[model samples]
Target: MIPGQRSRPEAEALPPLLRPRRRERPAGRRGGSALVVGLLVAALLLALGAVAYLWVVSDAWRVRAVEGEAQRAQLVSTSEQLQQRVDALQSDLAASDARVEQLAAEKARATDLREARDR
Candidate 1:
């Protein structure tokens, strides 16, 4: 017997269930369609991932814009409160000056009356 050749009886002795099945298509032809499908699926996943990333980034920008508007509103409210305080202080200062002027006029009248009595 040759080193690698099988005897005809030995080759025929294997059961049909244990024999290797032959493919209808060649090996090169078999994987081509599957490769295209795999690449398309990969491309679809990549596109979805990019869209999700953009959505997340846009949402972050929206959140930042909302926070900035809130901060601006808060600053405006604070500035208005400070202006009110300034106006109130100015009104109090004007009332104080008026009272001081009235007191000085009364003191002058008293001095004039005293001098008139002395003469």
Candidate 2:
């Protein structure tokens, strides 16, 4: 209501705590923080790659171990089969020997009979 004095602006009328803060420098001057963040990201990626490599190597070794066990099992089965076949062959050989002896005796008896008849 005074003739010469003017009222304060709305912003000035607010309490000091409600005013926005002012920066002396622009945000462009703080570009170094971006480089630091990029380096951190690269480090994280490298660590992840190392972990992946270890996992791959461990998996390969495990697969090899499993394959070796399977091969050994197959070999054992083959050995057992061969042993069974050998046992069967041995029994057959014994039977053949008994047949050979019987045939020899029969031949001798026939020879004797023929000689007596001639006399």
Top TM-score model: 1
**TM values, all candidates:** 0.53, 0.52
lDDT tens string, model 1, 1-119?
99999756443577987665665887787699899999999999999999999999999999999999999999999999999999999999999999999999999999999999999
Question: Model 1 off-target regions past 4 Å?
Answer: 1-50
Model 1 steric clash pairs: none
Residue-level lDDT tens digits of model 2 in 19-97: 6567655576566777788899999999999999999999999999999999999999999999999999999988989
Candidate 1 TM-score, C-alpha based: 0.53
State model 2's lDDT. 0.89
Predictions in order: lDDT: 0.92, 0.89
